[model samples]
Target: MSIPLAVVAGASGFVGQHVVEALRRQGSEVRTIGRGSVADATWDDPGAIEQVLAGADLLVNLAGRSVSCRYGRRNADEILRSRIGTTAALGRALANVGSPDLLWINASTGTIYRDARDRPMGEVDGDIGSGFSVEVARAWERELWDAPADVRRIALRMTIVLGAGGGAMSPLINLARIGFGGAMGDGGQKVSWVHVDDVVGAILHLHRHPEISGPVNVVAPDVVTNAELMAQVRGSMGRRVGLPEPRWLLEAGARIIRTEAELVLKSRWVAADVLHESGYEFSHPTLASALAEIAGRAPRGLLPVALG
Candidate 1:
């Protein structure tokens, strides 16, 4: 029998590439679309993406503009417009073509929620965020939901994905290795983090067990404050110089870096009840162990056998 095919978008980004590799490991074929020349479709060519999706087993949309760019009306607007526009175009294409009964997974963000006191935010707990990241998430998710119901769909509200390769964790990991990584602001704000392996693993679960739908939280169970995270990184890296940047310093730095002061200084303690309750197993459920493995300080755990 032929293996099922998946139409994957955003093949150039960190998680997107990881997803493609994960699927390949599971013996599934993948076709992609994006500008990096890695994916099969370029940004403006919706028909190419649509053609990729036609008769495919899955449609995974992970395309978006990175929100870490320096803050400006134009820059922030581009971030929002890129996500909204890509999602809109994809949705229109999916609607126009007779979509297969394949599963559709749209990428969202944990930044959708406002701050709370270490509270574990869930799917129904509405208070979607207010910053440029939140705005992008809001519009991106809306366009995703606009698709026809014939294709089963789900939105993955992802947290800060950590690994040795790419993402928000990369710069921090490098600083930590040099004994310079430290808390951003007051050290009181929380951070929700997940291992890149677990992020890819959970999607593998979705690929095999298609019943899971709606907005799934792709994060680790334990959330940490900036102080605690810095402490762990310092301890794990065997470092002694990690320190806290004062709020004023971070604010000033944000302006120079072209990002919002709040992005660097704010707390985001998201959770993953959806992933847990549904029997989705996480390889690095804890933060310390996850950090250790990523830093090559610990042994790689037993690899899970990928399902078809």
Candidate 2:
């Protein structure tokens, strides 16, 4: 049997790398397009995009600047431009193609939902937030929605993705190792998250389920609070205690790290309603089990120093 051809934009990213590997593992011929790779065509070249789309059975756009930094004006502009611009560019290329790809799965974020400490948000009834990150997500989705109807499109509103290498888990792991993985702020904010394996599985499921379209929350059914999340990290790392970070301290540290406190402060209570109804089973549903799987063994040799 011949393998399907997949064109993945921004496969170099943390999630994208895993997606590409998953595709290839499932017997798909994957071609990556990025600015850094001379072998692949760059996003600027409309001809390159159309060429890839023409032959591709799937088109996955994960191209965007990381939003893990302080949002100054210049940084904010780049963030918006990287997401919205790349999405628009891909739409134009898809339009020019002879036949649109079977499906286009563009990356979105669960942060698009408001800070709901009360209830879980889903695609049908989730409240969208305002400001830079929310605005970027809104506009990014618009680009995919406005694209030609020939291709089926689904915007994956992903939550905090946990894995071995990167995505939102690394820094937290490092912080735990150094004995600083504790609750931030009031520790009441909901932490909606998913394991990387589930992330890959969700993408594959979405690809197969042509009946599903639009925004779907890709998160584990098991949700945790900031306190519970840190507790799990501490337990996995074989630590007894962690120093809690107050809101003022969190704000100060974020400024020093050149990142935004909103990354830590905001409450993201999202649920995988679409995936649940689709009957997709999650491999690592609980936070503790997922952390243990990622850790693999007993974590030893702590720094003996703690951070506030």
Candidate 3:
């Protein structure tokens, strides 16, 4: 007979804001903890966050430096530090709290899985990849493992989240408009994606389903190839064609953009096996339909695409 109080760390981010809005829409009281916002407290004040968590039913940590930038020495270090530091800090805070019913949902990436061109990777059988991104993801989940024994924890191995305004969809839409939204690196790489709304829904579902824990794949049922993904973007934007970018060209473009080609070049064929087994139906299951919905709400602007 009481509404749940959800405390969202890193609440000012693109996904964080959407998750907060979704929680509020579901009649839950939301408190945010992050830097420079009117959160309950910033990361600098861990005690205040602990106080907030004591009264919370759910704690979702979406804090991390965006991996969309160029992975230079400085950037790469910060990327690792931000995720591990935030998760460790949250674990410390949770340790101080006495709430047994608290559920912590931390952000993990589907990129942790190897470049699986063979078949779709799932929670049970997916092979973990090595390298900078995969290492960061592994450490991120390790922090969660150190949390108190009483707390329930789940690491969302999220794929590329498609949404309006600030996600993979916006830049792809821009590229489609500019007639450069083409398949990269032979366009055979598999791209696993999920709608932002479904992401929110899945988080809530996991919160209610205590039977599920550990790293769960949060992607959609339908995964598309790089060529099909570009074609869908072009189709949604009313364009017929996109110039294909080869690996050499992608490397050059990545240097120019100060980012890596791995974001687009790597094959990430992931599936939501846990969610499917738990009976969680996706709101936007297919790439074409998901892109159409996002495109309708996407702002009309020529913002440069930063494929992460």
Using TM-score as the yardstick, the better of models 1 and 2 is 2
Clashing residue pairs, backbone N/CA/C < 3 A, model 3 = none
In model 2, the runs with Cα more than 4 Å from the true position are 1-3, 297-308
Task: Give the per-residue lDDT digits (tens) of candidate 3, residues 1-308.
Answer: 23389999888888899999989998999988888857888889988888878779888899998898889899999999999888888888887887778788999999999999998888889899999899999989988897654688899999999888776776788778888988989999999998888988898999889788888899988898999999988998888998888999989988887888899999999988899999998889888778878778766668656443
Taking the tens digit of each residue's C-alpha lDDT, what string does model 1 give over 1-308?
23388877887788887888878887888998777766677778878877877778877788877777675778777777777787777777777777657778888988888875657678776456686677777788888888654677788898888876666665566556655567777788888888888888877677666677888888888788877887787776677778577888777766765666666566786767677777888899888988888768332322222111
How many residue pairs clash in all the candidates, one count each? 7, 2, 0
Worst 10 residues of 2 by lDDT: 299-308
Q: After superposition, how far is residue 153 of candidate 1 from its true place, in Å?
A: 1.4
TM-score of each predicted structure versus truth: 0.90, 0.94, 0.96
In model 3, state the lDDT of residue 32: 84
lDDT of 1 at 142: 81
> Which lDDT values do the candidates have, in the order given?
0.75, 0.85, 0.87
Error of 2 at 257 (Å): 0.8
Question: In model 1, which regions exceed 4 Å deviation?
Answer: 1-3, 177-179, 297-308
Q: On residues 133-251, what C-alpha lDDT tens digit does candidate 2 reach at each position? A: 89889999998999764788899999999987667776787678777888999999999999989988998888778799889999998899999999999888777788889999999
For candidate 1, list the clashing residue pairs, or say none: 32-40, 33-40, 33-41, 70-258, 70-259, 71-258, 112-129
Residue 90, candidate 3: C-alpha displacement in angstroms? 0.8
Model number with the top TM-score: 3
Rank by lDDT (best first): 3, 2, 1
